[model samples]
Target: MTIMVLGIFIAVLTFCLELYFKEFVIQHFHSIADQMVDKNGVEPGNIEKFYSIGYHNSLIGLIIILVGFIPIYGFPVIYGLISFTAVGVVAGYGYIMDYDVIKTMMIAFVPHAIIEIIPILYSMAVGMYINKNIIKRLYLKKNNTSKLGTMCKKGMKSYLLIVVPLFLLAALVESFITTFLIDRYL
Candidate 1:
């Protein structure tokens, strides 16, 4: 899949960049970690944290869907940004902690990342589906509004039934299980 290739590319690029910009990358990772904490400098309780993570991811899914309207440039750019930023943080963690990059990712990132990445890729796929329909309508002189409307409705139903719930599950896993794994094993 295109999303998988793009995510792998971004992760590799970020890991390579980390070799050169270790300090900068680690600083950004710390800043991100800081953002996860509350004003009192303590992490919020699991329930509150789960809600926060779920809300943030759902907001991103909504934005990705809305950005599908731009037809060409919007989706890929946003997708790459999200992928690279996340991978970069993992790379930074590897650097600061002096762990094998791939191993660290497997142990600390993979559990929740597997769940989180799926809905994101699904969002991108939906965006691409919309783009394909738009291109067919505009560039190819195909006025298939009925078909497009049907597809759009299907996409919306799936977004509600599938993507949103997956993101919340991913958030729950990330907030609770991933944290425990990192603390206990990593």
Candidate 2:
């Protein structure tokens, strides 16, 4: 639920960012693609791409789930950064294809965007929730290693149990279905 809400908000925010800083955002993505191209060189097969997506998305999930150790600032900042990158991606795709923002976004988001985005959002939500409780404990001087350990364990359990599978599914959809759809339709 939190993931859905934040994802929607971030989608809208992405549009706004597109309106204001289009060049910068598009350039950023070009640079990232350039770096990836320079590194990968040869195009990966679909299966390799799928596995790569899983690995990268899982890393994002882990960062969101684990950044709770830094309390209020860490998870939220990373979450926002991730969200900003998503926006840039949408905007950048539009620029690269010379498509209008709306058309580009329609193609980008419809296929696998929700599947890929929501899990990380949920992981970030879980991290933020745990961080809140930890902050409360600190404020009350009720904090201890055992309690924090328990919280970390509980948060990680949920993230691993829930987010990991979702990431895998998202990766599969993105590498297979989404790209196929995009190639066929767009």
Instruction: Name the top TM-score candidate.
Output: 1
TM-score of each: 0.84, 0.77
Residue range with the least summed lDDT across 10 consecutive positions in model 1? 72-81
lDDT of 1 by residue, 140-165 (tens): 87886437677678778878888899
RMSD of each: 2.5, 3.4
Give one digit per residue, the lDDT tens place, for model 2 in 31-65: 87776553658767679879988998888887777
Model 1 CA lDDT for position 9: 80
lDDT agreement with native, every candidate: 0.75, 0.71
lDDT of 1 at 58: 81
lDDT of 2: 0.71
- Which residue pairs come into collision in candidate 1? none
In candidate 1, how many Å is residue 20 off? Answer: 1.8
Candidate 1, position 96, lDDT: 67
